[model samples]
Target chain A: MLIPGITIKKGVCQLLALNKFSVGQWLKTFDTIIFDADGVLWRGQQAIDGAPDTFNALRAMGKQAFICTNTSETSREKLCAKAQDLDFLIAEDEVMSSSEALARYLQQRKFNRKVYIMGGQGIADELECVGIESLPLDEGKMIGSQMVDYVKNITLDPQVGAVAVGLDKDFDMLKLAKVGCYLMDPKVLFLATNRDHSFPVAPGHFIPGSGAMVAAVESLAKRAPFSCGKPNTFICLHLLRQGVIKPERTLMVGDTLYTDIQLGYNCGFQTLLVGTGNNSLQDVAKLQRSKLPLMYQQIPDLYLPKLSDLLKFLPSRNC
Target chain B: MLIPGITIKKGVCQLLALNKFSVGQWLKTFDTIIFDADGVLWRGQQAIDGAPDTFNALRAMGKQAFICTNTSETSREKLCAKAQDLDFLIAEDEVMSSSEALARYLQQRKFNRKVYIMGGQGIADELECVGIESLPLDEGKMIGSQMVDYVKNITLDPQVGAVAVGLDKDFDMLKLAKVGCYLMDPKVLFLATNRDHSFPVAPGHFIPGSGAMVAAVESLAKRAPFSCGKPNTFICLHLLRQGVIKPERTLMVGDTLYTDIQLGYNCGFQTLLVGTGNNSLQDVAKLQRSKLPLMYQQIPDLYLPKLSDLLKFLPSRNC
Candidate 1:
């Protein structure tokens, strides 16, 4: 029996019920496709069984596929290298992460301002490349003498220009107080790097991320911070400004309903979901039951068992 | 020949009018008196004319005259030395500046929070004495560079906890932008080191002071800054907290009608104005037609030619 409210291609409903046609078969109509990493390409130690073949088949059908991830863990080049190691054909630019978007955004600005960053060297290095001075919060034992003054001086100096909020393990009250005081002056601007609540690390645990800190400051300041990374329209607009992708035909695909699907949906792009990522089938069902509903009504236009199953879904090129 | 609104003693009135007994004796009512520096001692240079003779006359009356100048220009040691050079007797603590009040206030609260400053080294040093970190806007440069990134990286990084607005020469659009963005975050606390709109410089020129910058940020953030200088109730409250002076008995005397007189009025102290200072006799006269007509209603209780003349007006110890 067909699941209530589940609409598929007319007459194709019968095909779905018979279990003969998987949802992956609908991929043929689109000339371009975007894939999500992690759950789609691989779960952890092993690659998804059908992903590699599906990608190769899509190429054979004269279709282009790109992967967009919100992961700050790896650069676009590194992501591409990982795909190459997995025996997949992918370009460097095709692998876009929100971190990369943040880096790109900072790169194009015509500002000589020095940045005191809390994020990894990736962000620092990116900022420097654009002629922006980058001061990473130092972490060394020999400089411990200056560290006391440094911590004390953190937000109290008007010379700081701006305080770049990013991921840091050593975050504490002093930092909070300094930021609070510095922010109280309306002349200083507060920018949020991203809005992801958490990023997956291992199977059973998810790490607290930027969204936590952002929420903390937002609650205190009683203002919404301008978000720079994924799902926020800024990153998307920046991407368009860079001529990286055609917004009209661009598709955003991911396993996570938020950050991925909503980003595509909100930006008026087609979205696709791959099972076995941040959310499982059970998690989606539970989300549907929750009172504070997720944007599940804005679900992906297409769904697949895994990234590799896409090859079988594409219509015959001759047809 | 008597001034229209002049209040002369009954006997003095009869003697001066030659309607009664001859002007045999004139009783000087006040002797011992305190003087505030910014408006009373000297505004940016040459001393008030009658300042010296007034003190000398008080001393002649066996009155213990003290020079209390709240000029944060020099340390207690320097202030005492300066007073000596200016022909006045004053102790280190007797020359109380708002800097001292701020330091004491922060110390009492054990506020270890970093203070982003836009003032002189005096403010920075004062905050440091209380173990509060100080970030001077001048030396640290404009914080706008850091602010842009701060606003952009709000979610991913640490936010400024408190913003201290003070006097800075290099205060510009960049500084304003940074401050503006920082204040957008609600967690940030807004403060003004002082609300002095203009600092007296040379004879005919004035530098737009901290109040101007504070006003700029306050306008954007839509909130009044927590000011900690003369006229601001914070310093008054701080003094009260430290048991330095009681609001009722405390008398604030200075030349500037805005800072000195307004402070005294707000703190419920008797306010005395020296005729010559930032607001000259001409400025005061012009106030009669001011846009805010009732502003002049809050006039000083005692108006003297200079701080020195104040000794002649105060009620005598024996009288």
Candidate 2:
């Protein structure tokens, strides 16, 4: 389980409030700062106020900033473009998204094989970029009783050595069955981008996340996938293998503790939870004392009102 | 929770080996017989040998029989027609399918409102026959990103007061979202036909069952529904309300213990497990001694090789 400088461990945590006295120490302690996209940087297409300047401030102090997101709808190139358009200057290489992480995972393992992807353009494009051909999920080809027939007649592609799952709007019974059938071969790896059950689009407006889709397929496949997103150290491990980010000298900043802060801790990084999104202070308080084994790592070492709040404690926004 | 003519308790059970001495007494004890269709009387399209003649012989002996199935693919009319084609003697009224049961449930509750059905034509036809209007989950209507916009732009039909889920081959992310959205209101009753995870279609082939679809929605909805099939007493309660089936005088027979045997107990009927489909003798043996709180009713009172095997103790079918 050892990956570079990262060591996985389990324990409860206490959140430390940011103050002027502790702000300088935070900026100089980390060589890289990893931030979650949706709630930490931007909500949908709109960037949270002062989020740009906060990253700039981190960079000005000689600390690198990376966007580590689980948003699977868009590819890394699109994510960089979107971030730039929102005034948050970002580069494609600095964007370690679930989509990109999956591709990296395949390449690092030297698994030069075609994939059957139950996902969207993010995964497809990433696979193509990584030189991994994907068996297309033809939406029009399968529906109603046709799904049964297709599954019956299906011949597993020998080239398809893996099945990659994510937040696929095109997810259907046919795709589910095909994946399950392919996974019947124990050697055929099952890879999921993330397992966030639901993500909030706006206040009180939540959509079923990729985890729901994953759960549906898992129910049929009778197995869990090697999920590459937060709370699983695979994403960070990928970064570690690349030699760009040092886990010991990294700070993980995010709005939610579950995927964000817990992921940071799993990868042996300093974790921070901001209160401007999905979870509340009370939610963290409950998880810190949670007896449920499932909530074991949902804790953080530090937290603030928002990522932008750190700007007040920074000296300058110039690198 | 005690019902008349039913005793509730616990402990391991022994499978009775029927002999000539006890066969006559077993036949005279129950005036009515409840059979689960897919695994017991039939497997997919083909009927188990001697199944048709067994029901006919039971009728000649003045015993009433019903085909109680969780297969939601076809309506009662179509089921009866299919039975006739397979040489099985079944009337429309005697075929109590999950689809028909759902419609009857709505009628019984007087919830005469439009339904949002995430199911097949069986449920649609049954609902129409019961005079309940439905908002169709037309497969062609929702797919890909269009699903996101459709879910967002969709206006809630105030008349839609319930959402029924079943075996839907067209099940996808869009349909999952729409149903989850509709069930946001606590007033919108959520109903599922059954929860059989995977059903064997052929010797080594299995298809993901209605339960997988239901699980997808339930994961998104964060709540379970009033599931109506085997193992749930609701279907039996519906029959009891009709005043034709006497619980004390009924015998429930099927191949699977999870649905058939537990359902028989849930409805206050004598249970008989047949080894013609799905489950094996070892499966039953394991369940008979299970101490899981949820599996208290899984043990059956009687079992044999098949329904046709009962002929050894009964008079010849001259009808």
Candidate 3:
């Protein structure tokens, strides 16, 4: 079958479309494959056509597959369950989420103090899994009608050693102010789950994401956060350090450019862009024309219309 | 009486302390004066010691004095009333607040459609004063428990032509999301009252300002707001355009450097820094050492211990 909407290209600078000849060669290059869950495998609650079979086929071929997402709204367990529900073979241990990354970061530091959270219950659950305590998410609300009264009456928790921000449904001014006060102590660690500004809810429709909440607190605190999601490089450094994957032999596949592609570039891994999510060939073409060297990092090594398109290039028995 | 904690210095690069010898010459250089409220005039409800007498004395010197503040919490009427209650002779029309500037901006554009506001009632009142209607401030809250439900069920008002943001006590994720949706249309105007990140609430304590709220929306919307307050130049450009004051002959007096001093530099007005608010000589010295040309804009032309210190330099009859 001919791939639609992709021109055959040869150079790494150009967005090369995976054809029968190139796909087979590309499959031999990467021993480990890291997939961005949301846009590559599925969008929202629905899995893309043939995505599950494509993912399962890669695993069946003896290729290591891991699900990496910037979502702070759910835990690894929930993500694994959702992936299983959508027919994609995934395990809790094979998933790495922003919230999970944050929890791991604290655990690595052996941080015992409580954390002030401005996110969903998932963040709290992740922290709890690591035996790290977090303040009640709802306790940050304003104590009175006036902002001054709230500012004057509210007291900062001396035990809070860090402030973690993620996509929050209940984000408000009081929480923003509370985070600001906690961050005033220079010793307090400021962490953000991810910095995806907006995420698509439907075709051409997007909603504010965790980055929006993080930006508010950052402005008030006058400091940038230590982000634990894609493009930060720190998220995937552990895998490289543990010798789980070699940079030259690893392939990072996703639908987003700035996060997935940039992360791949930062980690020295080959990147593949799929059209089922946030970006397309046009975005890559635009980036290719940019004068800045930084833009080149967002360009992918290869392109496919969707994840399922790769299944045809694999052996039928694997599928 | 000797002024405390000031070392006299010369040149614009140096933070020049106001002395008796230079006070008369400085007084004659400007026919009009702009004063920043809050720290310069008062701290909360209490007037800075001898501040009212100093202000009244400056007006008695035949200088046109105006109270310019970035506060969006109250109307011009309320600010004028507060000024009078604090013993300063002021007229309602003499106050140029952030909310007032925003209202005047819409009035100048002859905008007729309703505004979607994320601010205090003061913003709505100011818009009403100019015959423009704004959507109810409290109506933007989330309708359900889930962010997806809120995003799917909530509808954007077609009548809203502009989205105005200020220091909102009730700022939340829903308002941020609603603004994001409205801003998806390229025609909808995005306005911010000011970008003051944080304001001092008490000694060594600060609270999140309107800039915090604006930053969140700006990140989600992926657009910059046309700010109406200090440091934006638009706030005082009207004064220069209407021939109300000559920039060369006007003096901008305040306790903040980023807003008032930068506004003065942008407007070609002489800037005065008083040590009653956010910044001090330490900040000015730090800026002077910076290699960036932009940092020089924040260095004030003159400095005083407090607004009241200027009282000693003026004629007793004026006081």
Q: Supply fnat for every model shown.
A: 0.00, 0.44, 0.56
Cand. 2 Cα-lDDT: 0.78
| By DockQ: ranked, best first | 3, 2, 1
What candidate 1 gets wrong by more than 4 Å, as runs, is A1-25, A43-46, A140-160, A173-185, A200-204, A219-223, A238-248, A282-298, A314-319, B1-319
In terms of DockQ, the best-performing candidate is: 3
Position B79, candidate 1: lDDT: 62
The interface RMSD values of the models, given in order, are 15.8, 2.6, 2.6
DockQ, all candidates in order? 0.02, 0.35, 0.53
* Model 2 per-residue lDDT tens digits across residues B199-238: 7654334677888888777877778988887778776676
- Give candidate 1's total backbone clashes: 69
The sequence of per-residue lDDT tens digits that candidate 2 reaches over residues A1-319 is: 1223333344322223334654565556679999898888888778989998888767777788889888777889999999999888678888878877788789878998889888878998888888888887656344656655666765668888999988887777767777777777788889999887776553334577888888777777778888988877887775687788898888888887778988987788887788877776677778868888667566776667788877877786342
DockQ head-to-head 1 vs 2, winner: 2
lDDT, residue A297, candidate 3: 80
- CAPRI quality of model 2: acceptable
**Per-model TM values vs. the true structure:** 0.44, 0.82, 0.92
lDDT of 3 by residue, A1-319 (tens): 1124344454342223345665676677789999999889988889999999999999989899888899987888899999999998888888889999999899999999999999878889999999999998863353335777777666788999999999888787677777888898999999999999887775435678898998898899989999999987777778889998798888899899999999999898888899988898898889988999889889888778888878878888724
Q: lDDT of model 3 at residue A300?
A: 87
In lDDT terms, how accurate is model 3? 0.84
* lDDT (Cα, tens digit) per residue for candidate 1, span A19-72: 324443333334566677766776544667877777777777766677766555
Per lDDT, the best of the predicted structures is 3
**Better model by DockQ, 2 or 3?**
3
